[model samples]
Structure formats: structure tokens, C-alpha cells
Target: MLKVIFLAAFAVGTVLADGELIILNNPGSVHFEGSQATNQSFLKEVFTVVLGYTPKLTQPWDGVEIRDPFLLPEALVSIVIEGVESVKSPRGKHFPLNVDEVEEVTWQAVSRRLEERDTNNTLVRIRVGDGLDALGQSALGELKPNSVDPASLKHLSLNNEEDQKFIEELQLLRAIAQKIPSTVTANSKPDVYWFVVSGLRPVMDLHGKDSEATKEALKLLNDAVNDLSNAFTDIYNGQVVVALFTNDANKLRNTRSVESPRVRREEKAGELETFDAAAQNSSDNLNTIEKPITLRLSKRYSANYPVIFNIFLWFGIVFFFSLLAICIAIAGMDPGRDSIIYRMTSNRMKKDN
Candidate 1:
């Protein structure tokens, strides 16, 4: 019954795919050449394990073509036991159950454990059995007992070795999938087609170089190309021609140059308006910058400044100083015999002083 419930959750397909594939390699932080192949089949498998089960195997199946395979068969058979329920054995019930009852009990345990996903009123907790840490090991070298620490989850580790093994197995599956060739007909088919299409109609990056990150950055690039290649032979696939390489050094210089123009315009904003009017007042300013003209010079020239007066400027400066000198002299004059006006002013000024 537990196996039946587990199998029901996953749907596996072993059909040959008419889809595109993309294989990316970033092993040890180094990229390698990308490959393309045609005519591949995709296989899916599913299984289940109890929470306490150990020594479980995860492996690949036989009688299938695995392209760029990354996993082995022996690893697949391991059982992955995820904790499904937190229950004290019923009526103090211990282990040693019959095969007929195993399925029903396993399912009951799973349903109980699954209750945690639905509970929203309070903080959810998982009972970590024993002293397992993040690396899935008990205190020292011993295995943790079948007990959960709901509060000490931070210190708790997954003791499920089967799950870890399965993850590694999945990587192998992905590698093999990359090696297979599939057809790309529509956007929903696969991502490999996009990568191939980008190669044909290359787009230049901002720095006038082929984009290094575009193939990796854009998801559609890979799907469109791989799928299209799979759909038809003789279509370009599996080739990574450089579309753009960012020149960081040149970009930095351009960023610095961008600031100068902004600064010049801001500083000259109001000052240039006055300068332009003065330049227009005198043709000499325009003459400074050489210009070709077809018009002949006239013998007669008009002087417009003859009507504008220069005398008022000089007279105004003189009058201002004269009034200032008079005020200072009067302020220094004696109060006794200056005049009646002085006397009246002196009397009032002295009283206020």
C-alpha cells in the first residue's frame, strides 16, 4: 500500500522524445565544448522508501541509451526514507509487523507526517530523530535513534543517505538528457533551439562585441536551437560562435567620459546666455571663428554707438562720491556756529546720544 501510494504521485514516460536537448558543462568552474546529437529517448522512473530505512540504493535502469551519462546502476536501488509521520507506536506496539499489514501502516505513517505541510495556525515542526546534524550523521559516528527533536531542528541533520544518492543520480540523468537529440517545433518543445538560433542571427553586445553570457543568460536561445536541430538535420546546431564579449576596460573609460559633458553643460547654463548676447553685439566675436562668405564688403559702414551716451556714466560716478564727501564733512563740523539748522539738529542729536 505504501509503494502504491508513492508510485501514484509520479508519472514516468519512457518514450523516445522528438525534442531538442542542451548540454551545459561547468565542471570545476571550467567550461568545455558543447556537443549536439540527434535521435534520443527520455526515460523516467519513480520509487519510494520509509523514513527510517537505511542503506538504500539509487541507480539507473538497464536497456536504455544514456547520452553523456553521469550515474551508475548500482546506486539506483537504494531506498530513500523520508520521515512521514511522528507517532508513538499504537498501544505500545513494537516492530516486527506482517507483510500484509506493511502497506497500510506505511501509508498511515505518511499521511500523519504530511499533516505538517497543511498546518498554518502555528509554526510547523519536524521531529528530528536523534543527534543527526546538517551532514546527516548522529553524534560522533553512531546513528540517531528513532526519535524526533521538534525544537532542535537547527541542530538536526537529515540522516537520509538514500536521498543524497538520488540527487547525484539525477545529475547523471540530466547529463544523459543533454546528450540526446530532440526536435524543436514550438516554444513549448525545448530550450536548445534558442541557443542555435542566436548563433545564426548574432546580436552585438553594447561594447560592439559578441555576448558571452547571452547563450547562458537567455533561456530561449538554447531551447530554440536544440529543438530546431532535432526537428531537421542540416540545420545548424551545437555550434557556439561568439556573439559578444564584454570589454570591461573600455566600459569603465566610457563611464568616466560620460560625466564630463554633464558637468560642462551644468556649469555654463546661465553664463552662456549673457555671453551669446554680447557676442552678437560685436561682429568681432563672430569674426574670431573663421567663416566663408560670398557677400562683398560695402564701402560705407554705419556706427550705431554714436547715439548712446558715455557722459552719464562718468557724471553719475562723480555725483555719488561728491554726496558721500559732503555727508562726511558735515558729520565732522562743530555744533556751535554752523547754522540754526545745525544747532537744532545738534540739540536733538545730543539728547538722543
Candidate 2:
């Protein structure tokens, strides 16, 4: 038994050391809750397999709330990771979060976006966060070891004051946007377009409620979008991308309540079916893509290393046991050598004769 166990462990280790990469996209539909959930699942799996990390997947609301803002807070993250594809193994793992920051606003915004009547036709929201830094954080922690300044640790923060400053900037931009001359004639032959991005806190309480922190946060986001748009106008031709991120009173209501219960139920059923099909198709496409891609440590950094490690470990064990069985069979079938008991019995038989 001891020999068998050792052999098994060795076999398992070898397989894991040589795993493969898998890619998955974020959810793009209203019914599917975007790709955030898939992203989290991929993260948990990869971290477990590669680095022996065990991160949990929480509900979007709970997960969003606990996330650190300054770290890389996007509503959706795209993950890529290496995982086993054996008959008895977990399907795959991926690392998609571009920024590790919480998606507090994005969650609510997604909810609102999905609930709208014309949601199906809306342009897919594409968001990108700090990319290289985001990947580093996902692989390890936020520590720049090779920095010339030794005190870099003191300034290094996964979540820091920068988020607040950015939020404030967003509000100021919104203010500037409101002031921008709306009279600028729409460009008939626009050469360049302006794009704006902004964000804000959630919406809670409507009556006589007055919370300075919340109000100020919202204003900052509003201004940020507006100002960013204005800047684009100044730089570009007559037209600009009119993009903005905000926590407006109406923005939070991206999802609307269903009026008729029957219709609502039917719509939900249809949406669910569509989302399921889309998810299946997306997964299949990813699998096709991963065939040519080599798996590496960087690829599977977000996975829980131990879990992944154990899978290969099991495979090794199975292989070892198989070898042990072969050895035992050979030992049992050695017809050339007689056993000691058999030899002694044969000598006694000759003496008796």
C-alpha cells in the first residue's frame, strides 16, 4: 500500500506540471449577468491549481461591496488560465479580471441595463482598466521589488486614495459638461468623436435623506464625464465621443420593474434560454482557441494552485499503480524459479520413495 501511494503521488505530480491553457470571455448579455460571474469562477479555479490559493466566489452584490476600489474596479474582467482536461478533472480555469477593484457601481448598472425594454439592441459596453498592473496584481500582490526607491512599499497600495481623487475628478468633469456649449452644431461630417468615462456611488433613500459623502461622490462622477467630453471637443474636430460614467438617480434604475407578471415571466424564460446558448457557444469557441496556445505559469496565475496541482497528482498516482500491477504480475509468473517450500517438499518425496 505504501509503495502504491508513492507511485500514485509521483504520477499525479507529473501531469499537473504539464497542464493546458483555457480562455473564456465575460458575459455580454443582460440575462447572463455579464461575464463577471464566469470571470470569478475562472479566478477561483486557476488560483487553486497553480499557486495553491483558494479564493471563493461570492454573489455579485456581496463580492462587489468587499472589493477594494482603487485596485482595478471594472464591472467585468476577462480571464485566461491553464487547467486539466482529463475525464475526471475539472473542466477548466481562467483569469479575466483586468483590475482587481470592486464592481459596486457596475453591478447595479448591469442590473438596470438588463431590465430595460430595449436592452437587446443596446451596444455592448466595453470597458478596459489598467492592464499590465492589473495582471501583476492577479498573479501576485502589489509590491514593486525592483524599484530604485526602497520606500516604494509605503506608496504601493492595491486600494488607495487615488480612487477617491478619480471619483472627484469625474464629478468636476460632469459639471464642466453641463457648462459646455450645447449649441455646438452637430457635425455633419465629423472627423473625430469624443469619448467620456465616469463613475459614482449607489442610490439609496429618496425622501428627506441628505448624505454629504454620497452626494459629493455622485456630483464628482457627473462632473468627470462632462469635463472629459468637453476636453475631447477641444482636441478633436467638431464632434467627439459622448461617453460618461456616472451614478445618476436615473442611472441606477438601468433595470426597470416588469408591469405584467405573465409577460415578465415569459421574457425571463426567453432571456435565460438565449443566455444559456450563448454561454455554451462561447465556451466551445474558447476551447477551440486554446488548442494552439501553450500553457504557462503566467497564464494560470489566478487559479488555486493546489487544486490544479492535486489533479495532476492523482493522475500520477494512477499511473504508478498501473506500473506496480505490472511488476506484481511479472513476479507471480516467474516459472523458472521454484519456491523454497516446494524444493524441500520435493527432496522429502525423493527420500520417502
Candidate 3:
């Protein structure tokens, strides 16, 4: 039984050691409860900070028609015109447009002027149906074009009722990633999973009635993020680290709230230093105020010595049990040769025969 247990444990350890570490980059959508323009601006800033690129704005168009097969589809084309504008088509045709205009222009004409100052090059275009809110839909559409740098952008729908569960799962995957090693070799890089969540806190509080609800919501969000961190830690067996970035400092305040007084004082001092620097540099502007708080969830197992010692201890136990079992089996085999009763019985049986 002891041998079997040891073998099973050893097998499990081996499998975990050999298993490939999984890394995922899961970014949630930019959520905002504000004016359409405010929402768009906020989303642009988010993409700019997280992905390091700002996407150009395109006027909302109903439908587009593409004449050339080789050229980009008209649906994917975007035009930003301020007042009245004139566009020259590929067929040498001139078309005049008024302010806030939507035209079903040919792809050739659009592609020819794609590099122009006013025209915005979209990464991808999505057409929202009649029932959907166009502004909200367009905000989601803008995320992809802006997130072309670090990683591909995936805009998650905040309207899903099951978003809480999805967040929980993300947390679980992150926890798993934390247990695995970040780098397999000196040259090998660790897989990174990025979760970009936005608009968790409300932009305005009418009558200040929703304070408790807002706090609860923030708590839930923090819990989910923490859960993800813990899950990653367990999965990687303290290999992968979790880094959290948020514009709101309150979202991560709970993590420090439970720390010891001495630790909290240290953290507060660090935060004061950061604030002082920001103030001195005048970095707390409208665009930079919503800076992300990066929290690195490193491997909890700081050293390999303890883990190695534990492994050696288990191996010793298994070896000792195996040797004892072998000795016991060998001793049991020659019982009659060494036992007086057995020898007497054998002698009596021989005499009778």
C-alpha cells in the first residue's frame, strides 16, 4: 500500500513537471457609463496605455459597397471628415459630402486615399444591427484597431449576465499559471496572460445613493481578480506571477487593508513617494490620472531548496518501505527451515511415512 501511494505521488509529480505551461491573454472590454464621446475618449486612452497605440476615429456609416475585388471591402473603410469634404474616386469622378455624411463609396476610391490625414485605417469593421446601440457597438469596434501593438484585442461584452462566472474562471486559469515556471530555459520566455478590465466603477453618482452598491461591485471585482491570482499560483505551483493594472487605486486597496501595521506603513510610504513624484513631474493630468496599478504575483515558493528536500524525504520513505517489504517477504518464504515447530512436524511426518 505504501509503495503504491509513493508510486502514485511520484507519477503525479512527474506528469506535472513534464506538462507544458499554458499562458493566456484575456482582456475584457472597456466599459463606461457616461456620454458617448466620454466613453470613446476613455476607451481610446485605455488602448493607448495598455497597447501603446491610439486609434483614429471614424464616422458612423450605415453600409458600404465595394466595386473592386482586390481592394479592401467598403465595410472596412473609415473616413473622418469635419464639415464639408470632397473625395475624388478612382474613375476620376468627384463626390461632395456635407457634415456628418455616410456614403456607399467604392473601395478603390477609399483605398487610394487610405494614407490621407483625415482617413482612419481600421483594423476591422463590424456592423451593428438595428436593435443594438450603435455608439456602444462602435466603442467595442474601436478596441481592436488600437490594440495592434502588444497583443490582439478581444472586446468582451459586459452585458452578459454570466460575466461574474467568466471572471471567476479567468481567475482560476491565472491561479494555475502562477504555479508553473515562468521560463523553461534560459532562452525560453514565459507565457503571459493579460486581463484588461475597464469601467468597473461608475463615472457619476446621482444623489450619492449608489455608494454602497458601488463598493460592493468594487469588492466583487477585487475578489475575482484575487481569485485569479491565487488560482494561477496553485496551477503553476508557484511558477507564474500575476500582475494587475487598474486606473482606480481603490480596487486594489483591499489587498493592503489586511496587511500588518508595519507592512501597511511601508506600503503607505512607498505610495506617498510615488504620489510625490507624480506631483513633482505634473504627471497627474486628465490623461495620466487613470494610470494602471501593476501588481506582480510572483511564485510563492521563493526557493527550490525546500521543494528538493521534500522530494528527497518522500523518496527515502519509499525506499525504506520497499527494502522492509523485500526483507519481510524473504523471511516469510523460509519459515519452515528456521521454525522449530515446523521442523519437528516435518520430522514426525517423515517417520510416519
Candidate 4:
């Protein structure tokens, strides 16, 4: 009964993606024709090429024919390049790029770069599952188990291999679906066709695992796929959707799981100590970190000198006038002869008399 539901869900997802393009990155068989390329250069080259060919989709079932590729005047498309560093330059030289900071590099700019014949000598053989597994693992690893609810902890914990696998699969599906909405809708486009660039390896690995983890993973993956289908359906309501698929889709779907040697060795070595240490470090960082306080001087209250000077000026004028009035009053009024002011006035009066 579960398998039946799974198949039905898969069928629905496949139908929804009938015209969508899936670009898979195969990192296992990268071949450099000329000089060895650095990770930075290789990434830039990949972005340049992939972005250039994204808009022009051709009919695969029929003879090769263009699918009416045209320029989008103000169509805002989001590009999510997974596994690549966000920084355009070396770190420390400038702030590292956050995932949220990735903005659209205009299709025109990409096309112009391609037209200039700015090609790299590296020829990477596109494989079935390139960076998907690593990306999925990273996403799952970043989850803080303690931060989640006790009920949610079981599903998120990596202590059990099966649980880890399930979480990885679910995260991979979510990641792909997330990239589309995050870039397209979050940035600009609301009702226009948006594109997603992702790897298929992690999603493919969902089939190979048969443990309880696999069951849970399948359920989550199905839900995510359904959500993506609904989202894209709404996005494609009145717009033409175009996607570019590279490499063979059959191979991508049927690819076997290749576990990283480092991951396997780490599993053999107890992860408990490492996990505890990491948790401690994170707790320490959080505890010791100070929240920044910003001080702002408002325009309305920032200027004090003018107000203070005005008050002082008014007080001085009043004081001077008060002193002069007292002198005039003393001259008009008479006091006893023993009074200092009276003696001075009498001496002046006696002289005048």
C-alpha cells in the first residue's frame, strides 16, 4: 500500500515536470584539457557555460528544434549555485558571500562573456551524482539536534546511519525545491516561469536504501516533490517555462550510491566525541557572543549648542537689565544716612544744595 502511494506520488511529480529541465553536475570525472584549473576558475567557467545555454531548450523526442528562445525584458530569474563559495574573490580580501546575497547575473552579461570566447581548457565529464550527496550531507549536518523538539530530534539525529540517510534524502529534495522559490519569487518574479539548477544524485540515492530511514525519507521526499509541483504549477499558469537538461537523465535516475571514504572512516571512528565537542563549541560561542548595540543621534535632538547659546544669551540680557533697573531705583528712593547708598546720595545732594 505504501509503495502504491509512493508510485502515485512519483507519477504526479513526473507529469508536473514534463517540460522542466534538470541540470545535473557530475564532479567525479572532471578532465582538464590544458592547465590544471583552480576551484574558483572551474566554478566561474561552469556558471558562464551553464547560464549561457539555459534559455535555449530543444525538443528531445522529436528532431532537434529550438523552443522559441527569446530575451526576457525584465524577467527576474534567481540562480542558486550549490557547493560554490559565494565570494567573488578570496576571503579576507572582502566579506564572504552569503547564500542570500546571490543576485541574478544578467543573461545578457553571460551571453556576452560566452560570445567573447572566454572558454576554459577544462572539460568536466558530467556524471550522474556530482555534488548532491555532499550538499545534502552538509545541510543535514548543520542542523542542531538539541535545538529541535524531542519528537523532531529522532528524525534529525545522525547517530543512527539510517536516520542520517533519511534526513539527507529529505534535505536534498527540500534544497532543490528551496532554490527555485528562494531565487525567483524572493528576488523579483512572482508569476513568471523560474528555473532551478540542481544535482539529481542525492534524490536518486533515495531508492537504494531499504531501512526504516529510507521509508521515512521516501515519505518526506514525496511531500516535498508534491509541494514543488504545486508551486511550479502556479508559477507556470500563463508563462512559457524553459529549462535546459544536460547529460543523460536515465543514468542520473539509475546511479548507484557512492559513499565518501572520509565519511565511512569517520563513521567507523566514533562520532559521539566529535559531535559532543562540536555541540560544546557551538554552545560556548553562543553564550560568549555579545549582541551589538547601535547608538543613533536623532536630527531633532542632536544639535545642542544653538539651543544652549540662545538660553545663555537671553539670561545674560535679563541679568544686565535687572542690574541697571536696581541702580535707577536706588537713585530714586531715599534711605537712612548710615546706609552706604544713602550716604553716597546725601553727599551728592549736599554738594548740589
Tens digit of per-residue lDDT, candidate 1, span 271-299 = 11122233234244223221222243212
Q: What's model 3's TM-score?
A: 0.22
Better of 2 and 4 by TM-score: 4
Better of 1 and 4 by TM-score: 4
Report residue 179 deviation for candidate 1 (angstroms): 96
Point to the candidate with the largest TM-score: 4
TM-score (all chains, Cα) for each model: 0.13, 0.22, 0.22, 0.26
Q: Which sections of candidate 1 miss by over 4 Å? A: 1-307, 346-353
- Model 3, 75-130: lDDT tens per residue? 11122211111111111112111111011111122222232222443322222111
Q: Tell me the tens digit of each residue's lDDT in model 4 across 1-353.
A: 43353345334433332121222111112111222111111122233322223221111111112232221111212223222222121111111111111112222233343333324311111111223433333322322111223366433345654445445444444554444443433211112222322332232344344445434444554464444444443443313122122122232223221110010112222111112242233332222211111232112211355678789999999999999999899778768876776766575655543
lDDT of 2 by residue, 182-287 (tens): 4123322212111222222222132112545444433433344335444444533322223111112222123221110111112331111122232234333333
Best of the two (2, 3) by lDDT: 3
Ten-residue region with minimum lDDT total, candidate 4 = 256-265
Candidate 4 Cα deviation (angstroms), residue 79: 13
Q: How many backbone clashes does candidate 1 have?
A: 42
Q: Give the Å shift of residue 178 in candidate 4.
A: 6.8
Error of 1 at 117 (Å): 87
Residue runs of model 4 more than 4 Å from their true location after superposition:
1-59, 63-157, 165-212, 235-353
